[model samples]
Target: MCKALSLLANSQNLFVNLARVAIFIVMIWIGGLKAFQYEADGIVPFVANSPFFSYFYKYEAPEYKNYKNPEGKVVAKNIEWNKLNHTYIFSYALGVVICLIGILTLLGIWFPKIGLVGGLLTAGMAIVTLSFLITTPEVYVPNLGGDGPTPNFGFPYLSGAGRLVIKDVIMFSAGLICASNCASRILSCCACKAK
Candidate 1:
């Protein structure tokens, strides 16, 4: 037990590196998916509602609700609407940015200066994503009338989208951690050079 504890304790740096790798993997996979039609369509609510991003779309919030394309399903009119809104174009550009951030983060394994920038960008991206929880109405369960008043249809109650957005908190922390680690490395190099 003591041996295992010691090994685990000694592996902090390894785990941090692993976190960078994990970030890289997640960013790459999710970013890559943005190029696809379904994935691009899925982000409409968040983007359309976001004050920071709503301008990217031709239509306004709530307008996108009418054009949603469920995963694995498609309708021509909806596609045409999305095209007019430049959904795919925005998504492609976002994907490229995400992929670049991931690459920069992964490169942090060796280049502390670059890694620091990457880590900060990762945190920034996560912050933007987390903002969707507040800006996107879809993030919460709506009070859709049913047999009676829905017991859980607001604030504290999280819909699937809310749950998804909430998870960005982890990415935010990891990005800070990576940034700190790189900063430490950079400082240490500077100190050694002074000697």
Candidate 2:
């Protein structure tokens, strides 16, 4: 048992590499989805309400609500509105950036310098995503009036969107870990050179 424990304890570098791979997988998958119509449409709520991103859209917050295109369902008018809003254009650009970050993070396994940038960028992206919890009303469950007022709605009550946004906390930490690991490697190399 102690032997196994020792092995595990000494495998921190392997684990960190694995984490980098995991981050790459997640970033690439999610970023690629941004190129799709449904995926682009899904982000409307977040982008429309975000002060950092709202300028990319021609319409306002509630205004986007009216033009929503449910996944897999095509609404011509909504598509037109999205095009006018430059929704797809923004998403495509965002996707490319995300994919690049993922590639850099993966390369960090061998090249610490590249990895450092990727890790920092990953954390930055996570921060922006987490901000949706505050800026996007869709993050919380709305009190959809039924026969009676909804009991579990609003702050402290997370809708699907809110749940997703909250998960970015994990990504934020992972990015920091990767960044720190790379920084350590870089410093060690510098120290060895000085000797």
Candidate 3:
């Protein structure tokens, strides 16, 4: 019984280590992309076109156009645009913060506490963004004239907007995993000392 328990614990530790490593790699990649604007044409362009990216653009992108409300009786004005430099600085700062958190988490330097905080922030942002996208009626129709009327695609759940909504849910789950006890549970099993 003792030997079996020991073996199980070791296996759990190995799994946790692997997960941490994977998370680190992904974070580094994302952070680098945001910081350097590397490959903006490749993945960035595709993601920009994606429903998930649309939410980001709606709130953050100055070039995004505003649309009339569902009633079509009133035209919506564009939100005030911040200066390009200000927006870039804010975005870069956010990327740096996320990168730092990811690095600390991967190191297991702070374990549950920092991990929990980082995960919570990530999850919160995703949820809020998701909610905004879900509630908005306007769908982003790429390549259409910027000032043209909004397109009408029936069935809210079947539209491209739906894809963005679903993607946010998946992203939220990933954040939850980082915030939850799964990592700690595995660590405990391995007899690894928690930070």
Candidate 4:
């Protein structure tokens, strides 16, 4: 039993490290996408629907709607217009912020202090993303109970938005674990120095 427990405990660090690396990779990849034009366009729905983020799109809201056709084809001119708007500016800024978080988290590989801070920052971001499950309707699978495509309403029935945000829960836990581990190591190092 002791050997079994010991083996289980030893794998904890490996799993935690995997989670941390996963978050960093996701942040960098998603942020890099948001920095571009098409992705900037795609994120409009999410940003527009977000109460916390909607203010950024207030002035350009009409142009945003204008970009869409009945068939859902986005016209070129309005895409250009959106690219020039404050909404796009905010998105690009957000992208830069996400990329910075990933880079900082990566720095944790070399410095425990950096890791702790990065872990906390990533955890904060994960909390905010998870909030979307409540704030954004996109998270809920639409058309259920009334004989539509999606037969269920919540939880496992999540839409694309929900799937995206729900995955952040793991990141949140991972970040907390990373920070805790880093904190313990740092404190132990200090204790040794004092001794």
Model 3 residue 172 distance off true place after TM-score fit, in angstroms? 2.0
- What are the per-residue Cα lDDT tens digits for candidate 4 across 7-113? 98989877767766877898899999887666777666567766678787754343466564223466778666675556578878999999888877766666778
Instruction: Please list the residue runs of candidate 2 whose C-alpha ends up more than 4 Å from where it truly belongs after superposition.
Output: 146-150
**What order do candidates take by lDDT, descending?**
2, 1, 4, 3
Q: Write the per-residue lDDT of candidate 2 for residues 1-195, one digit (tens) a residue.
A: 999999999999999999899999999999999999999999999999998999988888889888999889999999999999999999998899999999999999999999999999999999999999999999999988646555788999999999999999999999999999999999999999999
What are the per-residue Cα lDDT tens digits for candidate 3 across 48-131? 344654444324332332321222132223112322213334446556765775675565524666666655655665685576
Runs in model 1 lying further than 4 Å from the true structure: 146-150
Give lDDT tens digits, candidate 1, residues 115-187: 9999999999999999998899888998876465556787978999899999999999999999999999999
Residue 181 error, candidate 3, Å? 2.2
Give the lowest summed-lDDT range of ten residues in model 2: 144-153
Question: TM-scores of the models, in the given order?
Answer: 0.96, 0.96, 0.48, 0.80
Clashing residue pairs for model 3: 9-190
Residue 188 in candidate 2, Cα distance off native in Å = 0.4
Candidate 1 residue pairs in backbone clash: none
lDDT of 4 at 172: 89
Count of backbone collisions in candidate 2: 0
What is the alpha-carbon RMSD of candidate 1 to the true structure? 1.2
Ten contiguous residues with the weakest lDDT in model 1: 143-152
